[model samples]
Target: MSDPTPVFDDLRDESDELDRLVAELSPGQWALPTPAPNWTVAHQIAHLAWTDHSALLAVTDADAFRGLVEKALAAAETFVDEGAETGARLPSAELLARWRQGRAELDRALRASRPGARFPWYGPPMSAASMATGRIMETWAHGQDVADTLGVVRAPTDRLKHVVRIGVRARDFAFGAHGLPAPAEEFRVEILGPSGDTWTYGPEDAPQRVTGPALDFCLLVTQRAHRADLAVRAEGPDADRWLDIAQAFAGPPGGGRSPKGDAE
Candidate 1:
């Protein structure tokens, strides 16, 4: 795989795009409920900001970040939601400023890290490139909540290639997280990129395959949409199970979004 620094740049660009979108919102708009149960637009941004700050700490101050991680693990069940709640309590201006600062600092810290260095995270330590990709995936996912709440459509982009790549690379982790052993046979993944070119992974002779649009695969792996709403098709038992529980981001298994036509 290519070095992900360029992809990291794209990630920062995605964050800037989201920042622009929320920068124009009114106080009432900030309060709009998002797809995440009990979380509003503010909550979504707040969570992003908190995680960005955490990522920065992970890079710049490992000891302090470890302390923070210990506290979060102690309240594992509610830690994520609690951070968002605390952040959402800030005024709109303050919240936006904090988010902007946090992301900028995170980008800088990531770039300054030594080549091939790994940073501590809630789960395993991640390289700078991996961390950047995760941040990009998260920013895009949360931005989806804001867009959906506002009834806005975000045009699909080739940037989704990064997300798709991460999803494919995380295949084993997905199965392992659920206490299932990865299948011995490698799985093939072929998805149509936004540019109309095909992006593929795994060996062509692999018995198991997943084929779909890049956007759908990205949404599925990010847990932003249910597999039922996507056009992803899987062959073989291993591929089927992977599609069922695939997650690109770190942390515990998530409760994926409901299928279309189902009440939230």
Candidate 2:
């Protein structure tokens, strides 16, 4: 995996960016719809904060581990199963504040933990480093949705590797999530990042170059943007379709891609 320190840094930077944006929003702005259907800007922040809270609780207190994991899963389930009514009715500000605190705790836990410390995540045991990286990616990717809704663009940061890693590793997952078979052959992923970090996955020369600004690539692959809307490109039919169904985040498939532009 990429150096763990930078991963945390990217996550931290992204988290900070989102915090800054949300902290300054007027009360009315908090209720605006993001690219995510039915979710308001406040809901997006709440989800990120809640996710971070789960991460921190899992790492810092072992006795609460199993229960925390279950709670996290249940929260995702509730979010997915609930409709607009749920979002509209939920306390948006409280959700955001809860998550904000959760993230603060997670940042502390990550700093104190060892690199390979194990944690219970979505599947298979993963290292603390991986979990931290996932948090960074998720936080930033969601932050992008909020930023898009506000029409405020955040400059691509070097710390995007966190999400880029998930985007590459989760490529094969697109097929199954879409009810299609996993590819018979492996696909390589190449990311041209903002800070000149070149990330490659699969074989050295496997047939795919996700050439474009790293931010756009990450945003698109994370299902935050439509492939056609961004400068991102995918070679071969399989690669292209993967972009159509690509989802770096966990939980049920987010409603199909937005039509792009104002449709966002």
Candidate 3:
């Protein structure tokens, strides 16, 4: 694939940006409820910290990581919430320190892996580049929760290109995850990036097409917002169906967030 080093750099930059943002929050602010159900700012950072530590282990020690994954899978339903709740109980300073350390170690471990080596994940094994890009996407998505909680409107950046790429790439995976066969036709995506440049993916002449602002597309694929709230529009039956269940991250099918103004 492309040079992963730049993507790794971007991952670290995203982590650093989040670290700086959270560092400025007061204890009360850290406890502020976020858009994610039953999760606060502290819970968000804690989740990131726990996942980063797990990812570091995945890269540095495959056997141990596999065991951990097995254990987590055995307790799949509660595992995520348990980890986040446990970590969120830490003192604010300690929570921040652990998250910072986990991210740093993860970056280093991913960089040290062989160029084409794959690491086990909740879904399929991911190469170093995919792992880095996944981390960046998670960081940005969770950061959005934190930003929304604080009423901060983060300016869009080219870094979002990674998120959009993954969103487009996951089209087939999304369908298959729901036990549906992927459509035979290629789906075209045309996104207007933050910088006013058109970011296009897939064959330009494809019959299926999805078009919208890059930010809205990212939000949709990430499940951060309901499709009703975004400006994305899809043409063709396959493209329309793909948008209904598009998920950039791997997992059991997620129940996407409710539409704007809906009760939680």
Candidate 4:
């Protein structure tokens, strides 16, 4: 079993950075709308808190977690928004406190999980490190929405490796979610990280390839930016198609952001 400590630490750092961004916001600012349709800054944090609570249940109690799964299955489209709505209605201070407490508890539970233990998730069973990586991916992605709403420009960090890993790993899932067949051969992915280090995945000399800055790929998979706005490029039809429909987070494919100026 891979030790989850590093991803756990990165998850903490990612959450804390987002917390700092919102911690001092005025209540009115908390109500400011973000790029996600009908979602405010409060909704972004609320969604994170709701997911952390769900993760806590998954790690601690299988039966309870299944109940959550059932609820999600029943509502399908409305459940996520409902969860965020409930939390978003709370007073800003109370909401923040709840989010902080829930995530901290989740961290402790993940750290205490037995080695090699796998927990059920909305998509598939995940080990501790995978779960932590998912959390980091989400925190960073939703934090991007909050940062955008606040007109803040956050520097890309090496922590994005977690997001990039999930994006790459989810390649097949992305295809399946879109009702497309995944290519038989793995595509090479080469990403330049913020610090000028190269991160590579799959075999070198693969016929299909993707190459880009790590930050752009993360944004692409997270659906925070439209493909047209990103510098990420693809070689070959399968790889090019993957770029169009890529999604890092689970559930149904998202209604991705429109190309810049198209929405305006």
> All candidates' TM-scores?
0.95, 0.85, 0.95, 0.98
Point out the higher-scoring one by lDDT: 1 or 4: 4
* lDDT (Cα, tens digit) per residue for candidate 1, span 1-264: 466679678988999888888999999999999989999999999999999989999999999999989999899889999999999989999999999989889888887889889999987899999889888888988998898899888888888888898899888999998999998888889999989999999899988999999989999999999999999999998899899999998778999998987965
lDDT for position 137 in model 4: 97
What C-alpha lDDT values do all the predictions have? 0.91, 0.72, 0.90, 0.96
Best by TM-score: 4
Superposed by TM-score, candidate 4 places the C-alpha of residue 163 at a distance from the truth, in angstroms, of 0.6
**Stretch of 10 with least lDDT, candidate 1:** 1-10
* Separate clash counts for every candidate: 0, 1, 0, 0
**Residue pairs with clashing backbones, model 1:** none
Off by over 4 Å in 1: 1-4
Better of 2 and 3 by lDDT: 3
Q: On a 0 to 1 TM-score scale, where does candidate 2 land against the true structure?
A: 0.85
TM-score of 1: 0.95
For each candidate in turn, give its C-alpha RMSD to the true structure in angstroms. Answer: 1.7, 3.2, 1.6, 0.9
lDDT of 2: 0.72
Q: Per-residue lDDT tens digits of candidate 3, residues 19-64?
A: 8789988999999998888999999999999899888988998898
Stretches > 4 Å off in candidate 4: none
